[model samples]
Target: MKITRVYAAVLALTSLLFINCSKGDDDNGGNPPVQETPTIEGTWKVVTNNYFEDSKYFVINEDNTLHIFYEDNLGFKDTQNANYTNNEEELQLTINFGYGSLLANYTVSSDDLVLNFPDGSISLTKETTALAPDNWIKTLKIINEGNAPWTERIDIAWNGSQLVIGNGYEAEAIGLVNPETFALEGTITTSRHAFAVEIENYDDEEKYIFQSDNGSNKFHMYDLADNTHEDESLPLGSWIYGLASIDYQTIWASSNNEDSIYLYDYDSKTIVQTIDLGERSPNGLDYQAGYLYICANGQLYKCDVSDGLEVIESYTLPDYSITGVAYDGSYFWVYAEKNNEGKLVQLDLSI
Candidate 1:
């Protein structure tokens, strides 16, 4: 009887061990842990202290398309489109307004995303709401058009009291233009083609005109008092396209071939800073107040000085190609050829 009772106990213990093993398999072996999918396809916004830069919103779609929207305080809006590709590890963007093809290391959390750029890193947050598109080009209009010298390239600059236009690109003169009527009244014969021109006045006694010839890769200074070329012809080793005065001793020059703008000091004969615009070639340049206006790819861009000279706003026009731009005290002017005739026109910027 004792042997039979021991056998029953052993059989009962084996049955219990089998049941525990099966339950362990069902709980741990048969089922695996679930994982979350990774993604960054959503509308995002960058919050910044700058009033203009803070208004940028980036909308990323699942179809690998990206749209950047900008709106100012006055409700004027603009849009830029580009292609983007994002893996879990990296993000890539095609050509943009200020940057070229860019590859940035990225990290995305539940609602926050950060991208490391070459210059710096930017943080963005996912936005649940999307912005409505209102293109600003629809409101842009030319206020006036007037006769300009027959030249392939035209650059204009505000010379204190009037506008001086350059008949550049193989043409050899700087035409004195009446700002009110936009009429070419007189001309100053130049030894070489004046690709770009800027005027600087320190006092009534100190005034000069700066000129650049395209192939020379150098710029010459002329005293406005005597119209004589000064010995200070600065060479920057790159083709210069545009010139804008920053101060009496400093100026900015743009090289379309190098896609850079150089802040050069004529007195020191040194380059203070070289700003790279990536693939965007700066064709024409003008400085007003604390902002810089640039013409590139037939579009007008306004860059803020407080924000590292980054592009804050852009203006575009249909059926118009801008070769050069200038800002008078009250309005902006551009040199363009419409209907097969080269003309200088005042642009309305109220939008």
Candidate 2:
């Protein structure tokens, strides 16, 4: 009887140990399998093709939202937003532009994302992030040119309530019909070519103009209040092709022949700094916010004028020559000389 009892106790202990071991395995089994949902969430770059040779990029959010950015063959950068979805293998994206919806497809690979469009397919490598969009307000073209058409193009600037325009040879003033309308008000003729125009700092009550001749080594300044031009010039030793005001007292000018930018103090009329922008022919300069924007050889560039005039970013256009550039607080307006058409392009600056 004693032997049987001992055997029974050992059997019961063994059963308990087996039960505990089974429970421990059930509670803490090796990590469960990692299940992946059929979702593509991240940024994607668009492949280069005939229509978009410069390469476009896009971003996809977790909630099915999408943003597409590309530069058209015309050298214009454009951006559009929409929604996207993926079903196991194929991806479908739709962009609604009020006028219509644009549909596109994509096939994802291990290291590549290819966009399949109606025309052809574009393959893009998987990148860490998409490119930022361009910060453009609006583009205003000197369309009518005060009803008097001229052979050469003119640059424009704003001085309080007046609109100032400068041709290579003269500076003209116009009255603002509204914020967008310009009517011929007055004209100031200069002996030298007025390549660029800017409002001088500390002279908000008056207008100071910088005029540069084609081959002249110096740039001249004129005062609208006194109706007199100063003989003093900023000797760049090269042609002053374009001019823009950084602020009320600071001005920046670009030289095509020298391939440099000269920053001058308006009060002292002296050179403060200079920036060499490589070998590109720089022209049509305008300043907005904190950037010095210039159109050179059909491409657009933005540089920081305050510090050392470092190039922050650059973009290319399909066409190679732009006559003039203007910003209406929002978008970058470019006049295509090759096509003889005005293009108001929106740039996406999202990083």
Candidate 3:
């Protein structure tokens, strides 16, 4: 899934790839202690993130399993359960979070433990208190549901008071709802499925609404200032399943049947970067600061934008079908739809 590097930084980063930790003195009935893999089982807390601190934690148990836990501000709990294999060097984590096993460069140095991703890295500290065994991942709570039976993608945007949602499959409408009360505002139809919607006010006339489609693979840029549209389709060359605006000029989109995401520069009217994700069907992407959280295959991935779309952390929603994700500084707004039933949940990342 590697593509030709267009930037020098990406070319230089080809050196930091994770190597198999199984490199040690051959072990037999007479294995030396110096070549044996050290124990990495214990508790680790997230130490660095652009948005929040101490919000994420993981417990790597010696029982060949690991638990990643998240507690939101509202007391809702979310977690990931995965099987792990530590080959005396690297921990091959088989996160049932969709994409199966992920090889992370593991290094434990005193107070800090680092797991390097393909392009980015995550630093976890030794937790002062080990979490209780019974205190593993908890069941999620449903906060709100869309008024209309949402049949398509459930990508949402926050515009201060209300959440503007993209409408149904091949939708001819866009919906607005209060995030707090789930009160529905009047929906306006436009004869296109707003499969993915992004809210941006980047020094424009006012806030603008950007839509990425599932059917036409086009972009419908609507100016909220004048209630007019600059509807145009770009050569996506694939089906776009989601959209997220990075700024006024740049927006990111996810493609289905392809493992890569496309960086569309609306100002330039061209595809800037076609990010290659080795995993298939990159869907429902949202950008905040330097990270992009994407929902695909029931897994939520936190990706670093500086490098080649490297996944820093991936959390899987086992048994649950989560479709989209959005990060708004404090919390990660997660969405799920089943049988035309739409539900939105808020995860307080500050917690």
Candidate 4:
């Protein structure tokens, strides 16, 4: 009786051990671990080609919605609202347009993104959405606050000493402003309407101011020695909005009507090169070192000096209309208008 009882106990213990082992095996093999999906929620700057398609970017939100900006066939800036579904391996975009759905294989790293489509892949860098530093300090109030027309202050240039301003409403003279006091110390009397002013200071002996005539599609050159126009005028087919001088032989002029910058040969009095700014209306232009700083659409753009003139950097300014930009060795003097008030703002290179 005792041996039978012991044998029963051993069998019960063996059954319990076997049941637990089976449960462990089932837990190990019954299901696999799930993987977390990769996230694609950020603003991305498109850098597929060497030149930046400024109109092209992606703004993906957390709610599966996105905004894609691009230039249409009509050369107009356009945006598309879309819903996006992203996984670890694929991304699907459902645009509001007639196109139903488009899929692409994508990869995301720390700061880089690559979307592989049927044709090719588009490369993008994650854009930092941090607001620009508040480094712009207003130094002068050039225009009063009210319903003043934008033509009150048009352009500005740093002449190594004072600020030469173009008063678009005034047809007879350009004002020479004292940068220190923000006062209209003197005026350069000329017959041409001053819409844009640039100083071509080859040397102390040969300093001249180039002004774009607002009354007509033309430009005039005035000698600073006597503040005289010398009757030197050139026919500009389009409305020239800004001018910048490189040397005694080269000058750059921006045309708002044509959305292009013309490289004029001062000696030949002819346009040697034309840089097309693809749909961007350039307002003002200034040159420093080898880069061209452009004021377009209330922002400042820095472009290279090469043939392509690829935009290297872009800075967002205050919520004001940027009319002109000038670099004065240390600070950047910007002519901005807001609430019908125009001012000369001084900003450091931090922007």
Q: Which candidate gets the maximum lDDT versus the true structure?
A: 1
> Model 1, 1-351: lDDT tens per residue?
999999999999999999989977777745775667646778778754232252477777788777767664423345667777665533544334346666667777768877676666667788887653433333357887776667556567876667787767645688888877766777777886777887773556668888878556678888887889885546663667788787788887888788888778988888878777766677777877777777776667777755346766777765666767787777888876676677777889731
Q: Report lDDT per candidate.
A: 0.71, 0.58, 0.65, 0.68
Better of 3 and 4 by lDDT: 4
Query: TM-score winner among the candidates?
Result: 4
Instruction: Count clashes in each candidate, considering only residues at least 3 apart in sequence or on different chains.
Output: 0, 20, 0, 0
Candidate 2 lDDT by residue in tens digits, 97-167? 56766566866665576667777666666667444444321222232322222223434455555444455
Can you give the TM-score per candidate against the true fold?
Answer: 0.62, 0.51, 0.58, 0.65
Checking candidate 3 for backbone clashes, the offending pairs are none
Candidate 1 weakest lDDT stretch, 10 residues = 131-140
Off by over 4 Å in 3: 1-151, 201-205, 231-233, 317-319, 338-340
Q: State each model's C-alpha RMSD to the native.
A: 12.9, 10.5, 20.8, 8.3
| Candidate 4 lDDT over residue span 1-351, tens digit each | 999999999999999999888977877545665555445678877878333244367777888777666542323333456776766433544333346666667778768877776665678888888211221122232322222223454778987777778877744567776666677777787666677889884876767888887745567777878877643445554667788888886878888888888878767778788878777888778888888888877767677866557766656554667778787777777777777677666666632
Deviation of model 3 at 348, angstroms: 1.9
Candidate 4 residue 99 Cα shift, in angstroms, is: 24
lDDT of 2 at 318: 47
